[model samples]
Target chain A: MYVSMRKLIQLATVAFATLVAGASLAADKGLTFGMLMVGPYNDHGWSQSHYEGGQYVEKKMPGSKMIYIDKVNPADRPGLTIPMVVDDLVEKGATVIVGNSDDMKDGMREAAQMHPDIKFIHISGDDVLTGKAPANLSNLMGRMVYGKMMSGYVAALSSKTGKIGYLGPLINEETRRLAVASYLGARYAWTEVLKKPLADLKFQVSWIGFWFNIPGVTADPTQVARNFFDTGYDVVLSGIDTVEATTVAEQMRKEGADVYSVPQDYIGSCETAPASCLGVPYYNWGPDYVKLFSAMQTGNWKPTWTWSGPDWTDINNPDSSAIGFVKGSALNAENAASLDQFIQGLGDGSISLFSGPLNLQDGSVYLKAGETASDKQIWYLEQLLEGMDGASK
Target chain B: MRMQGLKRHLFEIGLILGMVVLFTTLLLSLVGASPLEAFSHLFAGSLGSWAKFSRVLNVWIPLTLCSIGLLYAFRTGLWNIGVEGQVVMGAIGATAVLRLGLEASHPLFYLLAALLMGMAFAALWALFAGWLKVRGGVHEIFAGLGLNFVAMGFVLWVIFGPWKRDGIASMSGTQPFPLELWFPSLPGWRVSPFALGLTLAIILLTAWVLYRSRIGLNLDAVGRNPRAVRLFGLSPSRYMLLAIMVSGALAGLAGGLQVTGIYHRLIPSISSGYGYLGLLVVMLANFRLAPVPFIALFFAALNVGSIQLPMMMQLDSSLAGVIQGACVLSALLVFGLRTLRKRGPSDE
Candidate 1:
């Protein structure tokens, strides 16, 4: 028995040595980037866009691999923290790590401080601009306000009841600004394009307190959407990270309601309910990710807050555009043409909805007459604009 | 005879381990993964290097603390289902103290004060349940479960209202405390030695308190026969409340450590479900204090290592939970079989 134990010990030592050698060999191969997604990879919304962007990076840069772990939220994977997962990714030979959520701000900041040698990219975070990020940490986000404007424009064009509902996720600066942008576009379409009085149009926002449903935690997005359709609202624009608004609109349409919905974030969000989808204002993160990853690979990367805008030459160009609006099959030709005009006006700087005479919900002047708001003013919009219904704080 | 008993005990443990391995292997094969690769990945992910092992220890700290606390309640035949809420309250209490001491001179004093406040708050929360059970005759399970929901709602309100970050109300939770308020750890160490040392000392104290003292005997007597314990002039209700309060105090300490040592902030999921996971650990340890620490360590290793399954094999990390469940079921089966063998055919 003692001789057999010694033989087993010898065999284990040989196996361990072989495993270590193989691991070291694998480590020398290529550049591996790690992605931490806040939702499932195939959620067909925000997280899916980021996941596909990672895929794009692998295809664009040869010998560069992408390793990702999704559903990195506390509700999904309890007891797991950002720094803990970052350590695992680094151990797997990932030189650059991307965290794709604003909710990951503190954790990413902590992890960035912990690993000064590795590059960290936090999406939709202001840490870099706020001067709170380490030298190795950068922030990346698309100018989604423009996309939300298009969504509101289309929702207004498609609405029969002249009432539009916004399905907002949480009441932060990002959600508030996006919701306001959508309302501005809708009001512009109602007053300027359709030649209707502003008072006849009803624009309201309902926040679910999170990007997605957490059952007992957040207010259910599905129920919130149904409540919108059950009321006189003929159009609902989803500002959350999921397709619940579109799905609910489809279900309500089947019940013979003349309702339409516009989903946000992913390019393919319209596919969930094509007949009811007016259009989707999606973030095409591929071009931005490729640019950043390439810079990191070539060692020319510097930490900067990138808020990329769409390529006006061709908004749907996958290689150039950071944001695009895909017109759904439900959009009539006449309205679609008008929508194209609105897009052209936006692209050429002919339309600037943020120019004000704008008042906040509390009757405070946000911008003086003929005064175009600065980037900081727009980015840190504290309250909903007047004529929009929602809790600002 | 003693040697034979020891041999039988070892055999039962071996049988349980074999069943767990067989069950997990079957599960991996059903998912089209190589069982050997999966097992090796699990081992390497948890115990590969010092960094990984330190993370596992971080998980083990709270888990073992909760498990040891559950032992006190279990000894008195109390089902402390409110341990989860108690942990949350403890975190809230700690955060309250830490928030006040954000700019204080001595960080260590505030840290100690925060942990004590955490323990005090959790003990009060547990005592309310005990009071309802002893006085109002409400079942402890129902009261505990109801309080869990209340605690959840209370935490959400606190996070989104009074404790929210300036100009931001989010589920991401309150603003993170500054690094100065963080529980100090040694360089290159993820797990705080102070937290680890405290947990070890608590475990030793609990073992002594529950097994080697008169209070321990009285608690056991109360659990076994409350009516007969009255002859000893001891109040069973008081003992019950005392046991649960002690249990809450320790669970609260776990929460305090999670805030100060791990998160350094009051997040919505501060407990990380360690309270519930501790229940599982205590159950799998067969409600024995001696095996509680080891079982918690194993579970913690599984929780930490399962991240590799998703990264390497494209498998959901819930497989770790499945393995945990299988081990508990297999141990129960072996335990049943052992009892049957000892009873003989005539006993039935």
Candidate 2:
């Protein structure tokens, strides 16, 4: 091949640029982290929390590079699959992979088995407990039931109608448990704390099938929230993955309806409807992610299933907490102080909410008198507890 | 003249493909990424390893079958945008048969029944749109889109009201059929060889039907000159209806295989835009059956491999869609320029 003098010089320049680029990449010894989100990163809800957690890992761990792909579920991104995403991340030097939804369970498991050296932390999936999860795979979740209970308590305290509504997503065990925990908190505050009869307090829930609207499968959460407000419910607690509850409540408030909402997933969701958002029960994933990534850095990474609760002393702590209950602007001074006292009681182990003569929706006894439910029992709750008005199957 | 035409087509294809590469590279560089690294990661994710390549083929088989079927409708100048609805209806049909728990007595019989039922359901769905287009003078595009929304609603209802697991509905989909009813997989692989073989066979059958038969010629006449079909005493509407129904049947069968072979249950996303992707593939192939499968495979590779861009390079997967659009746009532009140059001022 005959090469001109100018072509040779051009080739030399390209080679030098390539060499510099390669050296810059090799200079970073930081552990690379990859997150696969089920929704858009700026969705202002579930996926956003995971996105912030990934960012937190970079800031806290120092020398760690964080990368994330949003809207990853196959249903949303039709052509992309989870195994492909996991494989690509591993090839890009990401040793710590986070699959941020239950839908990612199968792919996370398969990826963990295929790449044993990489650590896979699947959030909110029981595949680790139910399936023979690979050694490199772990399940990380929060005891959001406590945060949910606080939301219910705040709703009950703020409600002028004594009827607090919960905008629930689907009829799953996870969703059902969360709704019932809210009911428990509502009933406790209404009957004991407020010295009112239990019969006078109404805690109703309406489910919209999925985490968000699917047009046909799930009813629109916005309309559902409107319906709850229309039906005389003064406060609506969200159990879905969107800010529709608070946003709708804010609109209704502007229309001069005295209503409040509790948003879920991200702590900053109250900013979407400051006047109507009473509080938000959100997942604080930073502490958990840092725990996993720090272990990986020390070469002592071992996959351990973790389900941590919030530090009751400081629910808003950005670190050392799995869930946080951020009081929104709508919370009044009296209710806010009571909520703080309730959190202190919860942290000191003085409160026992699950202990009961609890009945399932079918009138079957779930917990006998004075019986305390175990973690396994709570994790696999099959139906809504009695005294809650909702469909439970 | 034929030799000249062949040479021109080859030249146009090469030029368009080169332009597509150039534009996509420019896009990557503009986003502060190394175009070489991005392209390499994409290919590696799609075709580098056996497992990864299998995933590409897994998407390719259904997309190709759907595109080949679409080629039939296009030949008759009919746009079958409702293929997605047809796929959903097919899945519902298969689920109806599979939920009967007939796997133990006669597995093969039930499997075949499910496949046929799926095709029947889709054909019927497509025929409704055809009826509206012919008798009601409605546009096929609008009719097909309306039916697609109805099909989605129908699937959601079935999942929530009828086939809901344990009387509770969620996005997890229906319960899996008995293990024996599940589509047999290739040993130690995610791809179902039987499904793959069946899809390829159907594609060949469509090709033969569209290219070798008198029916294909009649459909072409109806599309190009309806007056000729009337002169031959053939009903143009009938042929148009046949073309759309066949397209729907193929799309439906793809949906059936998806439920039985891959997911083993009908979710709301059972179709997952394979019908739409098939439309893109057919367009990219210039509406020709000969290149449909190849184009479908290439598109699938782009989509499945684009995961690498997001995972490794922090770029959105939508980059793949942009590349596909650019390729189609460039090819169409080349086609327009060639036609413009070929015609003298007298033609205009």
Measured against the true two-chain complex, the DockQ scores of the candidates, in the order shown, are: 0.49, 0.36
Residue A14 CA error for candidate 2 (Å)? Answer: 40
Candidate lDDT scores, in order, read 0.89, 0.83
Clash count list over all predictions = 0, 0
Error of 2 at B221 (Å): 3.4
Residue A180 in candidate 2, Cα distance off native in Å: 0.8
Across B54-105, the per-residue lDDT of candidate 2 in tens digits comes to 7888888778878877887888888999998998999999889888755458
Q: After superposition, how far is residue A211 of candidate 2 from its true place, in Å?
A: 1.2
Q: CA RMSD for every model? A: 7.3, 8.0
> What's model 1's lDDT at B295?
80
Docking class of 2: acceptable
- CAPRI-wise, candidate 1 is medium
Error at B105, model 2, angstroms: 7.6
Instruction: Write the residue-wise lDDT of candidate 1 on B169-209 in tens digits.
Output: 67777888888899888988889999999999998988898
Write the residue-wise lDDT of candidate 2 on A205-234 in tens digits. Answer: 898888877665578999999999999999
Q: Put down candidate 1 lDDT per residue, A161-226, tens digits, no spaces.
A: 999999988888988999999999999999999999999999999988888888877889999999
Candidate 1, after superposition: displacement of residue A21 in Å?
Answer: 23
Best by DockQ: 1
